[model samples]
Target: MSVRLRTALLPLLFLAPTLSPAEAQSGTRPQDVIITYYNALGHKNYAAAYALWDRQGQNSGKSYAAFKNGFAQTYATYVAITGPVRIEGAAGSLYATVPVKVTAQLKNGQQQSFCGNYVVRKNNTGGSAASQVWRIDRATLR
Candidate 1:
């Protein structure tokens, strides 16, 4: 999808602002975070995309430059969520694994599809109400 189209659709993707305390306490799903990540990627907003990664991804031997450069070879990329993302949670754990099917279009005019899982963890360190957020810790793409 084009950047403009993706930008236009972002509002539709995230219908609400911050998650209510009730929703957060019950373990909110990471659908919005995942979709927004894809939106950043679709727009080729490397900085925005990289910012979605949790602390785990940041310290995973790949620097911010590498993370951004990784997409340099791709063009007109589109990430589609094929179905409802299933998030598995454990009692008292702040992390969840979200499995999803994604279709991507590469710059080589090739399309790649994969069933992968994104590890998302919630953090509440920031001072604002919206600071409590779910972030992508790692991605197992195959």
Candidate 2:
């Protein structure tokens, strides 16, 4: 292969193992939703991350402006799925509890860590195509 072609393809090879945040949002698995959320946050795509919440951010318990401002001091974030996701079904909806450990680096050079579970839900009954995918219902982190 030509040097230019090989160089161009090198980056693609490195990215093959991970999907972009947009692509990840289409994933059917609960864990994928959580991963996509964090990925968006890490990329500073607050709108995409906020939309991952149930009811399109209404269930996030914060206004859109507040949600984005909340990360003003955040430089970057990393999340680790700490345990196996627990899934259950109730009233035609599927819920998944995902354990995670998150570390955030602030713009001031401070780091904050949190560990907890996030409840993700998917509607199995009638709804728009967007609603059928898993979404973050709530979170308990400390």
Candidate 3:
């Protein structure tokens, strides 16, 4: 019985070393960053949502105050990842394009729809550890 138990546990030991605790905790995937951004917005956590943008929200093209105020008339928001996220590497960095559909429900019960791509990026070269994690670089919505 001990021999069989050891055999069963052996595979798990091999797999354990392949998984990194830091990677899991960092939410490095591009899709995860997109989801987290929208979820924060939906919950009205503007600061949390804005910080997901690159350059600490500078890449979002709006000041933190303006970004928060843009949603003043929005009662809630929803997002659907409409297609597969694609990641490409360039200049020692990874860029991911995530296609998404979003709906914003206004306080007056009006809904606005947006379809666009969010370009997320991660620095693969030299930077702080936090900079290595994915962040929204830019968004093109219509």
Candidate 4:
């Protein structure tokens, strides 16, 4: 029937990535990068999580100062993560370099891509500078 065909084909239609490869690699999806950083922040691993931000991101409005302050607010919200975050096509070439994919979701409560996609990084020295493990998103999830 027409209804059945449209329903079946709707999923394939939304599978397409809205942004280009470069944009898609911005890094802020899934549970790997951002979530890990969230956990580190929650655990008071400031040194470790702070190192995960990209150079550009650190320079943006999301600087170290902003991170500390914003984290305080984020912690105030949502009690805990509900379930396992699903990230499609997650890749890490090395300890510092990782590529993230674009997120997808349906209008209805049918499907949703794990919040974001980001590549996490570590520090080089005594908080000397934030290394590049993964890029960052302008939006931070709780």
Candidate 5:
């Protein structure tokens, strides 16, 4: 798999529960955005996951078909978002970086861990309400 895809899918193995209204309005909560993305992936909803990323993040400039195929090869059966997602920069900043770790339980019972940071930027699309959204602009794994 491509490194970028691996990086993206590593964190995509997990799912998070519903968010509270406060979190929805925080705009600075990149974790909630990551949780929502992985939650879509957990349900095999590739389209939804793809939609969560910024234009550049989608397929890393490759076709969506390639992106979907990448996740198909992951073999992840379960995942959990572990630790706190650290936010860098002040609130209302144009961009924020979030540190994340995900533990993926493979179908073969082997567990693997991936650590990464998701760089998300505040979406400036449309009017005020839409501009409040944040999208993953990049995913880097280590």
Candidate 6:
């Protein structure tokens, strides 16, 4: 499976519960936007990756440099995910619950598999140029 598809799917899975006010307007189809953003990240498209972030910076923030570093590090830390993703959506956004297995190849190579969730939004929200960027609103490991 493509990395983008993998990345996008994870958020959709955890997007259950209810919609938030942040996402007022949504794209006709959000899955496409999610997948595209991840695809861009895999290709080393920093700008494209940034586009995937809301850029509002709840905890992440508006600085491109900070966002880039955070984005790259997270991707680098988790090699990949395994299994089908569960998804949820509200208003104009979606979340994915991704099953992940991570083993620090350097420290001990101990393999572990667990589900992690990510929330994302489609641009169109008016804020700083970066706020319109798509991004992982929050990620939780279950």
Instruction: Count clashing residue pairs per candidate.
Output: 0, 0, 0, 10, 0, 22
Give each model's whole-structure lDDT.
0.61, 0.80, 0.77, 0.40, 0.62, 0.45
TM-score for all models, in order of appearance: 0.66, 0.83, 0.80, 0.34, 0.65, 0.40
Model 1, residue 104: what's the lDDT? 57
Q: Which candidate comes out best when scored by TM-score?
A: 2
By summed lDDT, which 10 consecutive residues of candidate 3 come out lowest?
A: 12-21
Against the hidden true structure, what lDDT does model 5 obtain? 0.62
Superposition error at 54 for model 3 (Å): 0.3
On residues 45-124, what C-alpha lDDT tens digit does candidate 6 reach at each position?
66655545554444335677876665433332332445555566656444545444432111132323445544555345
Q: How accurate is candidate 6 locally (lDDT)?
A: 0.45
Q: Spell out the clash pairs found in candidate 3.
A: none
Best by lDDT: 2
Clashes by residue pair, model 5: none
Residues 71-132, model 1: lDDT tens digits: 77665444445555655545533566667666655556566777877777665444544445
Q: Tens digits of per-residue lDDT for model 4 on 1-142? A: 2556446644543233333223323444433454454445545456555554556546335666666665452321111234444333334222332233323222332332433323333332333323322444334432
The parts of candidate 6 lying over 4 Å away from their true place are 1-34, 55-59, 71-115, 122-135
lDDT of 3 by residue, 106-135 (tens): 777666899999999998998788878888
What tens digits encode model 2's per-residue C-alpha lDDT throughout 1-142? Answer: 3556445433422222345655655676678877778777877889999998999899899999999999998866777789999999999999999999887767766678999999999888987877688888999999
RMSD of 1: 6.4
The candidate 5 region of ten consecutive residues with least summed lDDT is 18-27
| TM-score of model number 3 | 0.80
Query: Scored by Cα lDDT, where does model 2 land?
Result: 0.80
